[model samples]
Target: MTDTTEPTALLTAIDLTARDARVRKRHRAELRFRGYGIFSIGVAVAALLWLFTSLAVGGAGAVYTTYIKIDVHLDQTVIDPDATGDAAVFAKASYQSLIRSGLRNHFPGVTGRRDQRALNGLVTLAAPYLLRDIVLDDPALIGTKTGIWILASDEADLIARGKGTKRSTKSRNDGQAAWIAELRSQDRVERRFNWQFFTGGDSREPELAGILVAMIGSVLSLLVCFAVAFPVGVLAAVYLQEFARRTWITTLFEVNINNLAAVPSIIFGLLGLYIFLNVLHLPRSAPLVGGLVLALMTLPTIIIASRAALQSVPESIRDGALAVGASRVQAIFHHVVPIALPGMMTGTILGMARALGETAPLLMIGMVAFIVDVPKSILDPATALPVQIFLWADSPERAFVDKTSAAILVLLGFMVLMNAGAVLIRNRFEVRL
Candidate 1:
């Protein structure tokens, strides 16, 4: 038509081989895509490192407490008041005076009620509780001079933890400040592992607070959630995927399950509030109620995951079992379900992990209450770890800041353990068929 020979020559001049312009352009584009993927991975790793570093830096020091060893001279007149070891008399004694006397002996130059009060501020109020325990354990100690390790108050402990010098103003006045400085200079203060943080329950005093109760509550709630959700969810999934017919009702149910899975978690909380608390009249702040609420939230996840796993199993496996004269239920239970078991279990644990981290649903059922006593039963009033973290984070105390960070680290560690368990199950037991 128009210069066909010349046009063909021009087209041939541009080679379509690996060295062609189009091929080189595509190679460059592929390199850019690979670079983007590597960069994304690096960013994710950096973010995780940043998060863990921040938490560790903030909470590591809080795992231990600073103490001052004071020689307390227990006076029989002040403690026993008589030659009798009556329990009531021992309880009524002023251990605070004994501790104050110890502090006074440590620094005799400080006098007057104001200076004494300032000096007394250096030790926590819980120090008296320690002394009381010692005296009650052995009544003979009431009249002896003993060197007891007493927990320093939060301010002094902060200073001992190398938070600052006397100029940091953690003290009430220059006298107490100078006294604390003198103690630090003389190495009277020491830091030790805070076992109380694990053994004690929640307290208004941050130094006396612990997450034991909350940890127990979380365990109890998750136990109930697992007991109720696992069997029901798997059975429901099996019926829907393997046994149920493709009817309008089944389709509606499937659609509703999907919709429920997408619903906001707070809606489930409200549902729990109304159905469990209002209608059934279950005890408020009980782990049982929290677990039931979490069961509802976890159901759709387990069911969906189980169904997907079941669907992944080849139809030939069921057909082969049927050919061997086995019933449909037998084939499913013996052959198919076992293959899908690991996946279903992983899904269940993941769902439980999600439940463990949830606070809003627990809050709706009154699990956000400030409980100091450890719950002895599922029906007892309690708070979960997330709720405890929330409460601590809301407190204005500087000590709670580190405690909150420590709690968050604990929660993260638990979540990682759960996910690792899921991975282990998947890797060890997952059936290829």
Candidate 2:
């Protein structure tokens, strides 16, 4: 057999040792670099996850609130039962006065003017509505001992929910203990869901801020966005990818679309504010205007994604369809569009999600704040989730911090749902190997 040892393997023992040391030194440096790279990546991912967790926790608290139950004894002796026949008389302040007087029934033993004011703090601004409903449900309720839920004010709610702590008048430990003992013994407090948040209007008081109007506004705006952005974006993409001849016009269009995508969203909002609200004279804060603004912003994303989807459809399939006596339009509509739709939908949803989180443009258009009874049409002034969050964050009251977080959580949840839906659509449409 030929000698198997290579020339490199013929070194003396001392030379081999030096060469081995060099190899070890080189490998050690390489391993340290790789380890450091992995460590940095891990740290970044961990920090991002922690931030998301903190935001969700704080924001969730804003969505729910607490209140207490109180029964008002409404008897004919307190109201003139004869006036119930007339709607005008029944709707008079005298009816609400009966409610204010009912507060005395809750704390029968409490005395002093300040004590009376503190007792009134338990009534919610929505109390008038509750009182009205009871009276309308049955005129007989005016004269009967009716135990109804009267919502508490925001401050009272905060104290009950542990968001607001009571201050002790005395610095002494015993003094603070005595004060706490007195408040707890009073026991005129209870906790119930803060339903008013979803149904009431914006007010200086947090208890009165309701999300219903904003929700309606958002729904209307999204409808407008889908109506305008979807067809336009999809059609432009189809033409560009399927039938457009190679020319300067198409090239120019592509360049513009790319440029538009990078423009600041706020700049688009300002443009919408000027073009739609001021120039067109569309109703300010109306869903129609806000939707159009968002449509412009969403269009570029949809067009780019749709073109990619169309291009992804194989030319071989198109050729086969054509050979089978299919018209170009028929081949595209039947074979291409079906395959591309899933991608198109995902792109559409992503664009919509982006629109949903926008606040600046909505604000510019007057969606900053409005308390409509209920949105009857697109022209109704409204607020959206992001705008509401911004407003709540600026509130001086300490409790609004929780509300700000809650709004953020809801916004984030909606965004997550839309993205998840996109993924599901993508999976359904994607061809498996």
Candidate 3:
């Protein structure tokens, strides 16, 4: 008691301002945390840059393919002898001989079966199909000399694209190398935009492959997915938020929804196979089945998002509507739902974007089929872009590597567009609350 004044005076001498030890320690901690956050972001961005650069570099040559402009002698003996419009007649003809004759006409110096075969190596196996289709479209070309730009084989295309040539002298069998050298000297080889890569379907020959069919299938599958998932997900969320009481059953249901969101995508595929394909007897590879599977996967996300948006709506707004003689249903449907729509849409788009990139689920349900024809209906057998990418990535042909990269670029573009759309919707409609 006698020394109280002196102790108080000593305590007062200690600084409690911005320069205090505790304050400096807190500032240092904040700086360290900020540095860590920046470092993490930088790492992520660097990884993305590396991936994009590698893909762009590897795939740049793929956008264009090499072709040889050969004057093919469409001999009647080789193509159509009877001069009939029968497709079967065209199908049975030995178009390979006609192609060989065309090559011989171009380079008279090439002789012997080995040299001839090497010369023929300049074009893809699909080259015959191209010739057949051209002849079928205009039957008049059957007996005439025609100039057509035929696609080169994978090896030749690779050489033209400066990747590698099977004809390199380093190979034990370098006969084709000499033939390719002679053709290059003659300027028969040329590079052009690969329109067939966009207009055609999957092919064993990478030069003949395209992404159109997969695109169509993805669109169809997403359409069905949205149609089923959106309304049902929103309805379920609203029912849980507004009508359901705080019961053990409802609590368990909430927990299950949360857990479902974390479940492996392949599990959903198995569920789809069991319920839709096995039990409901839906078409196996059709977009309808794929869409249903996606819907199940997407439902939990949408419901969670929708409920969160619903809860975010001010309780006072509901009270005001109810106080003004509006029913609870009217309050929620008219006022609350509209405010929550933007959030719901944002969530739905995010979920759809996730679905758009999934391959395993699609694979498990048979969307891995090599569908050449563009799908005309939901029931048609189809493959999505992700599945197509997986298929191409697995292909041994070097050209498929480029195709995979280009497809990835396209997929990234699509995903970016979708995310931007989500942002736009959210910004346009999100309430301040």
Candidate 4:
């Protein structure tokens, strides 16, 4: 009996050792998996940091603009040849000649027509229009010589900012480098915060270009998109989750909605082109059409997210409300819906943010037109921020590189703001069960 008992104890000890070994193996595997997860997260964070840093560095130059201070004799002969004293006369005047004359007077050594042409290239082509507007606003400045700061041409701007390596040689040969240096010595060349970058509209001249028009267009489109998508998406979600009976028809709709959420955004653009543009004859390149296209693209996302949010509410909440004498509709809308509204709004904001950054859909609907005037309404022909960024990125002008990067930063800023709003909404109003 003693020998049998000892053999049994030894077998038990061996089994215990085997079980401990297995447990240790599992712990090792878990540690490895945790390490892998941490590594992946670190990689993702680092990549995002790199991307932001690069964009900020590249776009830094666009925040400031170079200006050349010059004393221009607002020659009445050139500005008001008819002496009609009408603003129309000021508008039609060749202020370019005045600018050229001022430059020639400032540098007496630049005599030849070829050299004079090169000298004129130092200032922005919009300088004449700027002077014309100034005179029209203040007619008193028509005959006086005043010191004015005018936007330097893109090339001169780059050189002043120490970013003109590619054009440095050409500028030196054309005597433009010498003139810039002279202006710098006389305190006539300065770099200042570019208010025009925020206030003006698109321009062939980079210094005169701004994002205001595009920003307005984006806001108008988003307004239209939200107006159309939010109600439709929420109502559809409510009907599907609360009122619709469980059947093959409902199942088919669920499947189709899930599938639509995954469809390419450009397909929706094409659909908008066919239905809104060709069939309905809506204005081309209008923010109204762009918004409608974006609404179609964003609807599926909003519906899917809203449905998920609704499903997250516990069934007990609905049953309790109904047991207390509340009707089915009241139980769902009053208690269940309020609890889910935060999630629904969060989803809608995220969807709108995604739509804001979409260029392809807007492009398909002809929002890619070069719209110079700021739109006053959704029906006006306009270009969105993303579309503007795409257009700038494709430009061949060297200065546009900085403008493109700056525009991207603005786009990213809006996206971040939208996402932050979503997070704040969720945290502030989220219902805990």
Best by TM-score: 1
**How well does candidate 2 score on lDDT at residue 276?**
93
C-alpha lDDT of all candidate models, in order: 0.87, 0.75, 0.85, 0.89
Model 1 CA deviation exceeding 4 Å by range: 1-23, 86-89, 111-115, 138-140, 164-177
Residue-by-residue lDDT tens digits, candidate 4, 369-410: 888888989999999999999999888778888888888998
Q: What lDDT score is found at residue 212 in candidate 2?
A: 70
lDDT of 3 at 290: 91
Task: Name model 2 segments beyond 4 Å from true.
Answer: 1-60, 81-89, 93-96, 104-116, 138-141, 144-147, 165-188
lDDT, model 4: 0.89
1 versus 2: better lDDT goes to? 1
lDDT of 1 by residue, 308-385 (tens): 989888999999999999999999999999999898999999999999999989989999988889999999998899
Model 4 misses residue 328 by how many Å?
A: 2.0
Cα RMSD, each candidate: 3.6, 4.4, 3.9, 3.1
Supply the TM-score for candidate 3: 0.88
- Clashing residue pairs in candidate 1 are none
Whole-model lDDT, model 2: 0.75
Best by lDDT: 4
- What is residue 393's positional error in candidate 2, in angstroms? 1.8
Error of 4 at 427 (Å): 1.8
Residue-level lDDT of model 3, residues 108-133, one tens digit each, is: 88777766766787788877878888
TM-score of each: 0.91, 0.82, 0.88, 0.90
